[model samples]
Target: MKRIYKISVAIVTLLAGCSKSGLLDKDTKDSIDAQKFFNTATDLQVYTNGFYEMLPTYTLYTDEDSKSDNLIPLSVDARVKGARIVPPTNASTKWVWDDLRSINFFLENYQKCTDDAAKLKYGGIARFFRAYFYYEKVKTYGDVPFYNKVLSANDPDLYKGRDSRKLVMDSVLADINYAVANIPKEVKLNEITKYTALLLKARICLFEGTFRKYHSLGDHEKFLTEAAAAANELIASNAYKLFTTGGAATAYRELFARNDQDATETILARDYNTTYGRQSVGYLMTAPTAGVYGIPKDMIDSYLMKDGTRFTDQPGYQTKGFYDEMQNRDPRLTQTTAGPDFSVYKETTREPVNLSITTSGYRVIKGLPSRDQWGSLNSYNDIVIYRFAEALLVLAEAKAELGTLTQTDLDNSINKLRARAGMPNLNLAAANASPDPYLEYWYPNVDQGLNKGVILEIRRERRIELFNEGIRWDDLMRWKEGKKLEKPMVGMYFPGLGAFDFNNDGKTDVFLRTDNTTPAPAGTTSIINVNQKRLTNSTSGNFNPMYSTPCTFDEKKDYYYPVPTEDITLNPNLAQSPNW
Candidate 1:
């Protein structure tokens, strides 16, 4: 895997030319001219390396889940709060296309290199990134304008309206398919490869398929079929598996904590090295004033028991205190959240869950670094972009939605992940016979008849396994469950105001009181004023993070973001999304 570093000034200048410029300025000469630069395979490699910048960095671990119910940050997200508005100008818009222009520029000029193999390799990579770029755009705003070639400032197409979703997605499909067929088969943890292309194809197809199905758009089956096929092909390749060397007790958490990417599971990742620069994931997730991200009680309730049972089915489950609730649950719950034995970097003693860091009582432990890499801009763990477990889930989900899923499919896909977690394999028949009510309640739109039970189970699996990985918001959107965001966000249960031991280690972890005038009990690590925190029952229920602030999800307009007002004004043909 190549360690991504700063690119040369020549490549930087070439990329800068793709920015907003007039017709005459578009052709202006730079330090290293584009015509002269595209002469060798090494040049192609150097130029394409810039595309990695398009991938996510530490934010993937810090607060990417804030938009979904899986996490609650100190400050609610504007989108979650239904506070999004149409920006006044393109400058304030996230709809910029300079990256697309750069990729298109490379595609147009890569033929200058006489080496056919090098051209095909780099060309495939360029198309993969272009597909990636468009996938995000399509997710954000449906029916965006699709540009294949670099447009000159005077080009008439610049004033045209948005293209049809079919046209743009079809173009994206072709680019990803070409990438899968032409990219090298070799596995590179930090570079795009055949498997990475395959993963992207599956992801794009699954999203489009589910989104179309749930949104009542036509032609949903084709995308689902393609999604299953792409995932199946990747699984059949035998190139990757779950990273289980650490065993069920530690493998899952260690996978994200390691500084290096695990070749067994990670298909592609953003490589970060201490030598280049430090990453801020540790500080962002663990610092009191930095991230302030917490796992919600609703999400915590979704994790199945160790013996493969729903935690919500147990008697008195709602009011279970922190220590009792964390007992004998899915190992992932302990791995992902700070539990009885969880300690911060370099600390031998188990740290109490600080409400100041996480507004909710649950602190996220996934992607947290060791003692040596704990401070601001000091961690360097490689953030995963694609992994084998997701591909498996995609395959299982696509098949289930298509009504072609079978027990064998479960054995091949979902069960693989369950095995790595030391949990029992999911039985298709049993799951269908008795669907989990909690899952069905959360995803009411999953009406696949007999397949509905298994589908809901798969969604639950996806939610638990992929929590805090930055995929929940898209999952909710694709499933047409945006209203879940409006549901109350709460944390650990409290019978009433009193000092208590959260980890069951005989030490008072927190004192819940009504006012500052009341002194906390001795040895209490933290004091949370229940009046300020706002419990659901006024004094005894779960911690309510949004008791004072109400959140809304507009079914009509919240699904798609509105275009910038100035862009719509500049091109009168371009129309804004409905109800913006």
Candidate 2:
């Protein structure tokens, strides 16, 4: 049975009493007899199973990517549109600590178990989750109040001020270190293992390291060194590798489309099986009436040509149509988005780009499963949490930022991904000798002396390889490139605006016009009103779905979200974020 099913209703009822208002307010201890519950390995395992709820579900995979430059959704997010406001209470703030309270509650009483092995195992899992919880808090609102023990409502520490980033991160590091040292070195796809803890360590350290370096916070080298070391250990373990059995054409897409998580590459995943419950990933990615998220041109432009050359280097690339642009690019591009030749199955029927489904013409097909699964709560694909490919990227980026990267590092890290995509190897010397001006324009703040160019390439690789895995926003935040959100997001291009062939099958795939009365041209599969759909230029140019939405990024105030006014009012020492 799946670990998710093992969580009992009794445990759920116990954890449900945690209050969301004050940090660590509700004490569930009075409700349950901890002495009886914390007595055996099975008991500890059952209690710890609740911690898995903290992991992300399929919603994050489909929704969070829209907040980044990778996809344009039906509606612009308030954060992306510069419309976010400080909340009156903790309602809108991500400041809830109920999960932490439960984790800490378990930690405080788990020692009653007498089983040393189970105690250490479950204890490590609790600490790992605590580290994961704090990492998210730190990423959203820096300098959060760190708590290891479950606090009573009237505890003095409940009203204390926020801890320093350095102090809190150091504590998080300690927790993760404990988790790594104690967790069993076993391969469990649905359960957290030692390697999963290591991945979390590498992820958080890399975020902190780059955030410090870009935001001018001090002590970045310590975190970068730790990040590189963690990633190195994971890679040296040889426990996982990139999923390449599907080869170039299907390897990347198959990673997400399959129902089962490929254990060879996926270290940890959120289990979604038919017996448990299904998700809406297939419906959200393919339904014509509801699927509004679309891959943007900026992300589409990031894919390198098949021969390892930059796609932007080609002449007249900007004005190229959908069919033309799809030609000779990375195989992942066609696998991820709707091209002229895209089909859901091996049958002869082709899936044309549906304008109604995607705000941008570039419909995303990365996570969509078979046609039979495109119904509400019908898909059973597991959502990946940690994979070996990310470990490799983390190691390479950490080394590059630390100015310790070499050609060997590229061959092991970025080159492996490139090879999976059927692209040539990334030559460190060539990259450093002449950086892609296109990537440099996106990340002008990357100034690592001779390693600057290679760093830019690594960033590009990270973006392309991990496009919709819910990490793009954090990447932008840590790099201090929030302003990129303000740029106009566009899709496929059109020279004039009339009937156009999306698949290059000698038949009109779509018709674009400003007038609503005129009938669509014959053989057109879809008709789009440019006035409603929008274009960068009045009559022609790239499809600009969000042209009317005003997007602004205030570098001073936007990086970290403001704390709730109510929380600050309750405890005056709990200061609001800067420039809120």
Candidate 3:
């Protein structure tokens, strides 16, 4: 196998103890040579991998930060203090305040040193990484300082912070442009390919440009047109195609499972294996005993049938509930969630643990350590940040918004995904799903010509295609429609393995619940006993917690997340998002 290699530049150290006195107490910065440090071939190896690994950790917004509360995951430590989601303090804001620090470092210094193809390669890597990082910031924080140069801590100009959303976006676009121009179109055999940078550009541009255009922030139509054009260029390249049939369960599932051998759709992935990055997010979310995390009910419902109908809306879906009900439902769902008797699983270790979910009711089998190696706790799987499938979706969305989704759009956009699944094209009119109808509800001025609804459908495609690969929070934020949609978190809670019974569905054999005891235990009276379910305080109104809870789209206030208080203090000129 031809392995993708990186240029490894060894870390050079400055002589130690320069602060003591005399020769040893000399200034360190003066003694160290900045130019030679970055030029080392060994430095690029570590730098490149570090760049790839950092993408997932970039947390302007993450699922945990957005879930339950507008802070990091509700930690056990905080709950003990009787306070929830420790408010944004200065320390909490370091990452937020300094997200651009590293990117700026590389950008300002990359070109000062070497033309040694090896060092220049790292330059290209840094450019793409910086742009990619800024792209994420734009998506979350709106306007940010598009710093292309490193700033000093003592620089008096630090107070000149904040720029309008448009400025940041345009600058972001420019960086991607530079990246595309400077980076290769294809990398023969390397960790980060030349084609990968181009693909990243296409995706970032289309997303930002379409979002601006869809929301009518500024020259949206112009950007959308340009984005569509870029997307089309990628489509015509034909270097990638849909991963169809024999590809279904095992191959399709393995694509994200991080087995590099099966990464057909993956354009750029954060590879973790033999090396301890992470494997099977399953254990983190599954019923613990099952050795993985269970999938959330809402996540499970996101997949569409192979025929494009919702699993619930399909024939026998209600009756069979879990029988791959709609033959048309996207195969990705099965690959993501565990079945009533989930079939596609591999054993990696020999320990004997409960693969079945006795308490939580459902468990995730995808991306878990292979079944047999029960004791092999760690599993290595790569997370795909950019994939060709996403590129296709972006193309379809931009084209649909620009005008009617042309025949080519069908072939390139939705059809490619369907083709991979051996399904037919969606007759938009026949499907009775009008793309423009949401326009009526979204904006009153039809002349605005903003068919954000089309973009929302594209957003929907994104949700289904890339379910819970740690993107639900940002995906919800990016869409004008999701921001507008009123789907509240009104889904049922499965407070798995706790005394807190969300709702007792015990009466119906179809569902399982712990039920309320006749006498009741201390601190457990909050639930009402009925059937086998206990209705808890989490559900108070019409929406049954025993079944589903509430998630409403509070348009007036919920759009932008609040800026961490610490960030506001450091950058006084920066303004908070509206209504935050």
Note the Cα lDDT for every prediction shown. 0.85, 0.86, 0.48
Tens-place lDDT digits, model 3, residues 128-224: 7777777776765576655565444445455466577777767767766666665656633225555676667766766666566545676766666
Q: What is the lDDT of residue 331 in candidate 1?
A: 87
lDDT of 2 by residue, 1-580 (tens): 2433336646744853666574677666566778667899998888888888888888777688888788888887888888889998887568888778888888988999989999989899999999999999999999999888988777899889999999999999999999999999988888889999999999999999999999999899999999999999999999888899779988898898887886799998888878888989888887776658888888889899998899999998888888888899899998888778888843458875577888888888887788888898898888887899999899999999999998998888889989888999999989999999888878878865999889999999998888889999999999999999887788888888788888777888899889887787677778888888888887899888888788999998999898988888988888899899
- Tens digits of per-residue lDDT for model 1, 1-580: 4555456635744654754421112432442567787789998888888888888877887567987788888888888888888977657455777777778888988899988899999999999999999999899999988889877667887778889999999999999999999999988887889999999999999999999999999899999999999999999999998999679988898899888886799998887886777788888887887777888898899888899988999999989998899888888889898887787643668765577778788888888878778688899888888899999999999999999999999999999989888899999999999999888777888866888889999998998899888999999999999888777789989999888888786878888888987887678877988877778998798888877768899999999989887678767898898899
* Between candidates 1 and 2, the TM-score winner: 2
Score candidate 1 by lDDT: 0.85
Question: Which candidate tops lDDT?
Answer: 2
Q: Which candidate number has the best TM-score?
A: 2
lDDT at 54 for candidate 1? 80
lDDT of 2: 0.86
**How far in Å is the alpha carbon of 505 misplaced in model 3?**
22
In model 3, which runs have C-alpha deviations exceeding 4 angstroms?
A: 1-32, 40-49, 57-87, 90-99, 112-120, 187-190, 261-263, 275-280, 289-328, 347-366, 372-377, 428-457, 482-557
User: Per model, how many backbone clashes are there?
Assistant: 0, 1, 60
